[model samples]
Target: MVPKRKNSLGGGGAIPASAIVLGGGEGRRMGGNKLFLAVDGLLLLHCVLDRICPWFREVLLAVGPKDASSLSLLLEGRSWASPVRVVVDRAPGKGPLAGLVAGLREMDSPWAFLMGCDMPWIQEPLVRRMWALREREEGVLCWEREGYLEPLHAFYSRSCLPFAEEALARKDHKLKSFYPQVPVQVVPEEAFADLPGHRRSFEGINTPLQLERFRESR
Candidate 1:
């Protein structure tokens, strides 16, 4: 969905960067395209974009080639603060790694916030703080409890594209497999607790039960 852009933005000015939302996931665990599930009154993807567009200069939806035609006209009114464009995966059936590679290749901005479309509760303060650290490394993400890293909730520079493509070429699609090839700044999970929604920013609704749980919790 390409929402209408605002005439002028006013909140401390949006960060000079772009956002790449990974909408290309197969979503087999959810039965179908979970991004189409209703959230409040809007489609899940719209809810995610509405909040995100206000904080970035441009927004890109990295979707699967099969979904390309349907998603091309998902939005038709003034619902976002920035312009949005859709880029299809060059290699369909590949995971988020392929989507990220396609997004980075199409991205014109030096830095971009990359995430999954299932995330509609991303907090602005968390995003702003992360944007401030854009130049600190080739990639920046939050490290969760235990040994897990929240790769989806991160900022990636265009410089990481080559390494990502390298991984994709070798068929090592694990999102973090390419991390070792690039410089990364790991934001401690404690610092994440300082935000409004805390770790909610990293949580994604990947299944029907998880979506139901989120709806019931609200």
Candidate 2:
């Protein structure tokens, strides 16, 4: 059974939202499956799921064709706070945009939060703040740091489906390529200035060196 969604703002009510974790990357830089890499006694993917699953009614993991078996093993015998669904990219090698499209297509909620599987440092407080700011917004809601939008760590509405589809059809796989065609709310960095670890909330482990440094720091 899927767990009940709660308002991230502590309102004691159900919130209509889903969490989408993009895990279809080739991980060439990490030399292999980076999602399975162990960090703080938990796999990088699991660590991310554990932190964000409770905030949504359902959680969808977008994986590549070759990731099914490994991901199944990682999730076996484990229980989650929400129903977890695994979605494979419709078109392989199309990048994060493909994963996002696959995830949004399966989402039943009006809004979904998109997160990269490698972002193990994502903070719930910062996410809650973002969700709070997304109230009834009709398009994408993301944070901007140093003038660049954090598309992977953002909220996307089902209304973005058309734009996403258009981008894919045009062979433009950039995750933020459709932003200009939709209503986007870019949350300034100062909004999260008071949150703990706000500066590193969107940090992701990409290469082996970065992973090693992350593990050492932790």
Q: What local lDDT score does residue 48 receive in model 2, on the 0 to 100 scale?
A: 75
Q: In model 1, where do residues sit more than 4 Å from their true spots?
A: 1-11, 134-144, 213-218
> Candidate 1: deviation at residue 181, Å?
1.3
The numbered model that scores best in lDDT is: 2
Per-candidate TM-score against the hidden true structure: 0.86, 0.88
Clashes of each: 0, 0
- The sequence of per-residue lDDT tens digits that candidate 2 reaches over residues 32-90 is 76767887787877767777777788989988888867798779888888888888888
Worst 10 residues of 2 by lDDT: 1-10
